[model samples]
Target: EHGRGPCDCAEFLVTLVERLTQRIERHWNGIDDLADDLEEAVLDEAGPEVGATLVDLRRQAIILRRYLQPQRDALRALQTGQPAWLESDDQRHLAEELDALERVVEDADAMRERMALVRDELNGQASERLNRNMYLLSILSAVFLPLGFLTGLFGINVAGLPGTGEPLAFWIFVGALVIVAALQLAVLRRMRWI
Candidate 1:
């Protein structure tokens, strides 16, 4: 029903667009990865850590885009030539909101780009860490393999060293092994290999 007195047109339009923008911001500010079963399955396939962040961003983006369609349409309707959805005074409030929505869309795009860069950066760091671990393992194996063979061959009772036939021979080999291991550890420490 039409009101008898003039409605506070300015305040109503201001409140309307503000509420809409707020709703849009609540869901659109980030990427929107919805938490539906499908999204969860996708996240599971994506891997937990990076996948969660990406999914959230994706979800936010999707929600924002969905809200944005109507807002954009509203703006197009309010544009100078058309002026259909709203009158001239209402257009003032809507045009400002349209500008804000454009900025939001631009910011969302930037966020997507930033998340992509972060994923690439994290992947590179992970690879580098893996390689470093492999290199350390290789170094340790190289240092210990000969020592292991030497100790294995000499520990047998076939021949005579200082106490090969004695019960104390086992203790002597243990002591030698401890000494060799300690030397290896010292070298690794000095080289900062560990």
Candidate 2:
């Protein structure tokens, strides 16, 4: 009851808007830091935690946009409507706050885009790593399959297996196995599988 007028109320609202703008600026800075963290995590080939962090960053950006978009629209409407109670000075102050809000919104949008790019890069790196590991496993399996078959065959209790009784037979079989391995390696190298 201090006899405040309509202009006083408008001034108070402007002050509140200014404070909100300042807070949003701080929020935008926090988002910037998060984005930097995400980039570093990607470069370091961070694990699932990076994905979770990216999700959190995106969620924060979405929430910020959710609140900001409407506030921006209202400010625009106020500026365009120019109510009789809002003095010219109040309108100017609101315009400045609106500009600040717009810049923060743009920064948030850019940060989101950057996060998306980092996520794609992380996925690509993971997929490439998986493919390389699978290729190595396949090569190992290829190299070992014949060796396993030879060992199993020689271990069988069948009679009349060639060179079974000779004193050099074991060494000869070993030599044969080494030859087979060399041949397989040659073929694999020719095919560029290694």
Cα-based RMSD of the predictions, in order?
A: 7.1, 2.6
Clashing pairs in 2: none
Candidate 1 residue spans exceeding 4 A from truth: 1-19, 29-50, 66-74, 77-80, 84-86, 128-136, 139-143, 155-163
Cα lDDT tens digits, model 2, 30-121, are 88898998899899988888998998898888889888999999999999999998999999999999999998888878878988999899
By lDDT, the best candidate is 2
Q: Which lDDT values do the candidates have, in the order given?
A: 0.67, 0.90
lDDT of 2: 0.90
TM-score of each: 0.62, 0.89
Worst 10 residues of 1 by lDDT: 29-38
